[model samples]
Target: MTAVTAPEPAEQAKEGEGSLRSSAMRGGIYLVVRQGLNVFLKLIGVMLITRVLGPTEYGAYVAAFNVYLYSTLIGQAGVGVYLLRHPGEVPDLAVRTCYALLALLGIGLMLGLEASRGLLTGWTGVPGYGPVMAVMALALPFKLITIPPTIALERALNYKRVATIEIGGDTAYYFVAVPLALTGTGAMSLAVSLVLRELLFFVLAHYYVGHGPRFGFDGRTAKSVIRYAGTFSFANWVWQARMLVNPLIVGPVAGQHAVGIVGMTVGILEMLSIIKTIAWRLSVSVLGRVQSDFEKIRRAVTEGMELQIIAVGSLLLGFAWFGGIAVPLVFGARWAPVMQLYPYVALAYLAIAAFNIHSAVMSVIDRNTDLGLCYVVHILLLGLGTWLGVRHFGMIGYGFGEMLALLAYGLVHWALARRIGSPDYRLAGLWFVAAALGLFWRQLGWWTIPLPFLALATPASVRRIRRILEQIRKPRRAEARA
Candidate 1:
């Protein structure tokens, strides 16, 4: 074996960053796997608990958990947005201070939850959820407090550590509490699990952050961090509030069981999000690396868009193909409601991917103002759309409404796609499913015949795949001298 010298200090630092990037990529995969595994197990747990506790009880738990999720989003303070927007100039002290503000916000949220549990009980009519909601509400702090540290890890791109902690914690939660849940923890099992999960992250986040539990905050630094993070916090609150309105609307209008159905459908949607995140993980991070070089950024963005299209198209096509068995096996028969919504949700994800490159370019160029404005509008429209859809269309209608909102957003994304950089129009096949569904949705519900129909739905990727096969099969077809 040849003698190998260690890298010099500067070279080692470069190597460290290179390794970190690779780690981030692997961590994205691991995180996706972990989420997939947890969702898979939770599906088992949901099936067991649904069968055990019955619909009303499971609905109560899912409802309370939606509340918990919305609350957790409030405390992010958009630290990730802020950090991602300005990675080069974000000081550690500022990050610490932002963490401080979020901590305070989290504590206040917990207190507010405790103070309002009686109101929630009255509003929800799930008196059993009173104490459980109180406990689950406190989980907001545990979850939110971890964000700063987690964001730091994300910025550093040393995501394996964070991903490991998350996976380990989730695995612990599944193995430990799922049994109690099956034995008959009811709605409380979910609340208890939420607390346990958040607390685990709290401990792990602190360990990763190298920050001891301390309350000493700097007023000056806090003011600065607040000034920067305040805008993010507002955007976050708006987005979270937008998300919360769905459960608030559907639960009251359609009842807890209906909300459970909707949540179950969305749970399937969550799997798509995991796919989207993993596919875009490197694309998003690479935005940071290509900030100033417009020419280089444009080229990188082009390659990234191609990758996003191919990847998301393939995934969505696969999902649309296999979702019939996958949906029922994973989420249980009670959530059979999801069977109706899964394909449309896949279409929505496809629409999102259609503009993934534009999204990256917009962020790389620091177009948050425009992006935020558009999202704010989208959120407002979605809120109205969800309400009308829930009231008029019921479950399937809600899916229709979501698709419409996605359609509206997709157009905006398409228009902006040009502004960022023009992309191939062929990707629009992913977005026009709504147009197709409007034409054919009434004719076909869950077209599981596996005959000629489902193949017709995912035409965008099919065309691309056909082209690729042709290219592969006929590499010399283009090279023949005329």
Candidate 2:
């Protein structure tokens, strides 16, 4: 479970040339497809739930689910990140030991959550949330059990298999939740589906991995994983804390109906975040494969960021232009409040995309402490901002508060990257331009039709895009040869 030092730069480049290209192309396609299917299934769930329950009820369910999400994060204890970041060959004992620890954490998390039932109910302003959270807590141990196999598959770049398992779990969510909702389970449908989803994933992952858990401990391996986990898990907790700003802070202050609006907006915003998620995952995988080769990490980080900027920017732009019209049409008039709040939510995604590569680079270089420190600051700033926003400005203020936090988050990375002399000014500049164009398109409406033509008209922009296309095509060519 310890890190292995990479070969020298020249040797790395020689070995990496074709490997990186194929990995990027094949892995990128499968991951994108995986995310695409995930989003589609998620939309189906959302559509069913929204149609079945009114916003207030849906918000109540979301609040309970949020508590479950937070619990899962604590239960996970960064085991997945720890496994993914391991530089050496992962031993079976290491995996088993991690599972043992995760299972214990899961049980502890469930108990802690159950004990806090009164606080959770008060925070979400829904007494039903207490029992709903209790139901959702049942899934944690199953979720924890799946992590070892899941991370093993991902680290080996078996994303297609991993994606299959994930999609299968999501498919189960729809099948289980929708029928229950029709039967008038109310918020219970969501909680039940959440547990079923994890159980399915656990069974599928172990089946594919051809392994079962072993109850053994390896002290050395435990120390190694725990050493990394300490920082990574704390950062994740802070992140979950940041996530709770809406449900924990804003929900009680603004009321359940307001929480419903915020929940739907955040959900839609997360769907849009798939693009950034894909980019971040692929970059980490790519960097992890090369280990410590700084130059290749730089190239991968740069090319990856540029491509993400274009794709994420364009997607956000489309959402900003079309969401106002589409939200009402798709989710029904009941969800109209999402449209007004979504544009700002989209900005947070944009800022995340802007600085995501910095995170990959940080991981590659072992700057996790720095990254953790940034997360700490982000939580403090965002927590205060969200409270003020919801208390005074209402639902839209939640988006504004997050937007402000993400801006600060991006700035921390920018300054860090600058100090390391790794900031990509040109790519970073494009993010702002893209954001402005998206905002303008939303503001000016149809008049921005010619904007795409004008932006891509630049020779440099066109060439960069062409290079990205070539990078995408290289893996297909490699596959054809095989």
Candidate 3:
């Protein structure tokens, strides 16, 4: 046999990045379909429950759901990111490390919630949420268990399976949730459905992995993973906590009804947030895999942001155009506050779109310290903004505070990303202006002005759509040409 030689460093990096890009593209396509289905299911579920439970009951569910959401982060203890970052460094050891930590956190959360249900209810002022939250807390361990498989699948770019598991969990949640809500389960509907969803995900994920849960100990790996997890992990926690700022501050000051209003308003924002989620989720693993190649990282960040901006700009503008009329019609007149709150939330998302991939880039570039600092700034700004806004202007003021905080967050990170990614600031500016114009038209009831903004954005949106279609057609096109 002839002797073989290693490829040149530059050439090897090029190949690696190409592979990473292709994997991201393919995985992202599947992810889009998955996220779209999940979004549809969540929207339907929220709409059904909102109509059934009304504000007070829905508010209770939201309060508990927020607790459950934050606890999952605590339960995972940044293991998912750790696994993704170091995919090949003794997978079994990492898995066990994650499992051990997650199990401990999950058990602790479940027991704590069970014991403090009454105290929690009194604190949140959402009467029945104590027990509901306690029950929902049981899902945390199972959710933690699913993370290793998830990270494995994601690292392998096996998003087709990931998509299947997601759709299955979403289906389980809605099927269980809607019927329960219709039968007058109140906040328990959400709590029970969450357990069902997580259990289903756990079962399905394990089946797909073709393995039973393994128990082992790895002191060394645990320490290393936790060490790697430190800065970015804390940063992510802070960022997630920022989401809680409004409800936590508003609930105490304005009562559960106001919290419910904030919940409904955030639901609209979550819908607008789909583009950002899709972009971020798909890009992170890809960025991690290609982290050695700065050129690839830069290209990924820039292109990812562009696509996110285009998608978000179009969706948010369209929502702003029709939201005032649609919110009341869809969820009823009681949710009119959501209509007013949605414009500010939409504007916030617009700024976030400008730097959707920045965090992932930061993680890949070993800038976790900066990432942590960024989130520290974010939480402080958002917390202070929320408190002052709610104190002075009520819910609407809260909305303005959220908008300002997010803009500051986005602009700061966007500047940081520019230093690394070197993207087109002009395009980002245009998207921001376009989003602002949409907000202006919505706020002023100048419906005609937004029409022109939409018109201007339409060409870019269509081009993006065409590129996606071309991606889908590439193989067939090659066959035809051949």
Candidate 4:
């Protein structure tokens, strides 16, 4: 009998790395498809709900929803991130500990919101604000419980299952919310739909994982998780504070109608920047595995920046060119203010796309302190800029604040570049300048119409496009050979 030979460690490592890359690539594709579907689902739902609710009622919903979103940062506590980025297999004890912590935090946040419900209602001065918040708060525990199972799937790079759960939940939300809104349920339509979405997600997450995490606690595991989670949560909390600015500052300064207008502008921007969201989610899992390799991480950041700009820049510019007609036609004249706000907000999201990978890298490398400081600078600038601009310029002042906050990305870039040598931003920068100019075509006139095309015609841009085409084709060629 012939002797069988085992693979050497070097060969084994190479094979393992290849497997990981394949999984990550497939996972990324799944996420892109998922986000694409979500964007369609959410856009339709927003249009239907906004048309029914109008500015005043929708503004009230936005205010309460913003509070709920911000509060979730605390409830999450970043334990899921700790699980996702852990170097190797996480112990069952640690996973159970994370579950216990998340559940407790969720309950704590719920009770805290309930206790302060009256104050929040009085402060917002919007009808049905208190009840809406109460309903949204009830979803907190279910939302938190889904985290461990979701992280389990993410850790395994099984984004197809994750995508399925997310898409299903989102579909269920609009299915329920739109009918209720058409029936004149007002803001509460969204509140009820949100609860339903979380419940569905919670059940589906556990079911897909085969079993839910058994509740348990270990002192050492809890402490280690908290140590990492605390720093991570602090950075995230400060970052998420941006969500509160509209409700706390814009709502007070410009009133509910203006709040609705700004909220709608942001909501639309969020839909268009779905690529950024997918990239961030993919980075957290993919980069975490290669945290020890500075070169790999640096290359990933450079490629990610170029690809994101190419993907998102076109969408922003297209919206800028055509949104004026579409918004008024579809959502009614009440949403016309969204056009004026779109350019400024679009610019911010574009800048973020250019450097978002840096934030993900920082998290992978356990540089949460630096991340927290960057967030602090950003939130402070954003808060100050919005406050001064809103007070002075009225509704448009919020746009100015968004413009001013662009400087914060500079801080993030510097922090990350300091850690891992700077990424190649040439293509991203070119696309960014062209997209920025194109966004103000109303002000710049026909001259700006051809700029994005001009940017794409550059040799660097052409080379990048060819490389992307090759990458896409290579997969099909390999599949054919197989």
Please give the RMSD to the true structure for each candidate, in Å: 7.0, 3.1, 4.6, 4.3
lDDT of 2 by residue, 1-482 (tens): 22212234465467566866576567677888989999998888888778778688888787877777877888887778777776556677777788889888888888888889888787667657887888888888888888888877777678899889989999999988999988898888888998999999999888877767665688998887778777777766776675677678877788878777888887887787687777777777666666556666666667766766677777777777777788777778888888777777777777677677777677656667677778777777777778888778888788768766875665555645554556455744654565555555655576664565467657777887898888777877877897
Error of 1 at 233 (Å): 3.9
Candidate no. 2 TM-score: 0.92
Ranking of models by lDDT: 4, 2, 3, 1
lDDT by residue for model 4 over 1-482, one digit each (tens)?
01112234464377576555566778888988898899989879988999889988999899989999888877888888888777556777777788899999999999998888888767766666788888999999899988888888887778899999999999999999999999999999999999999999999988888886578899998899889877888888888899999988888788888888989998988889888888888888777766889998988898888887878888988999999999988898888989988998898888888778888899889888898898898888888988999899888888888888888888888888898888887887888898889988887797987998999999988998998788767655655675
List ranges where model 2 is wrong by over 4 Å.
Answer: 1-15, 418-420, 440-453
Per lDDT, the best of the predicted structures is 4
Among residues 3 or more apart in sequence or in different chains, the pairs in candidate 2 whose N, CA or C atoms overlap within 3 Å are none
* Model 3 ranges with Cα > 4 A deviation: 1-19, 87-89, 414-422, 445-448, 451-482
Which numbered prediction scores highest in TM-score against the true structure? Answer: 4
TM-score per candidate: 0.79, 0.92, 0.89, 0.95
Q: What is candidate 3's lDDT per residue for 1-482, written digit by digit as tens?
A: 01111234465467664454565677888988888888788778888888888888888888888877876776677777777766444356557767777777788887776787777677766776786887888888888888877776776678899999989998999999999999988889889999999999998877777775665668987788678768767777877886566447777777788788888877777776787887777767666656777776776666666667667777777777777788778787788787777777677777777777887788767677677777777777777887888888887776767665774565455555565756556555655676666666755667545543564457765675577577547645544675
Give Cα distance to truth, residue 132, candidate 1, Å: 3.2
User: Which residue pairs show collisions in model 4?
Assistant: none
Write the residue-wise lDDT of candidate 1 on 401-468 in tens digits.
Answer: 56666645654555455555544454344334433343233246544333223433477556755765
CA lDDT of each prediction against the hidden true structure = 0.61, 0.75, 0.73, 0.85
Q: For candidate 1, what is the TM-score?
A: 0.79
Model 2: number of backbone collisions: 0
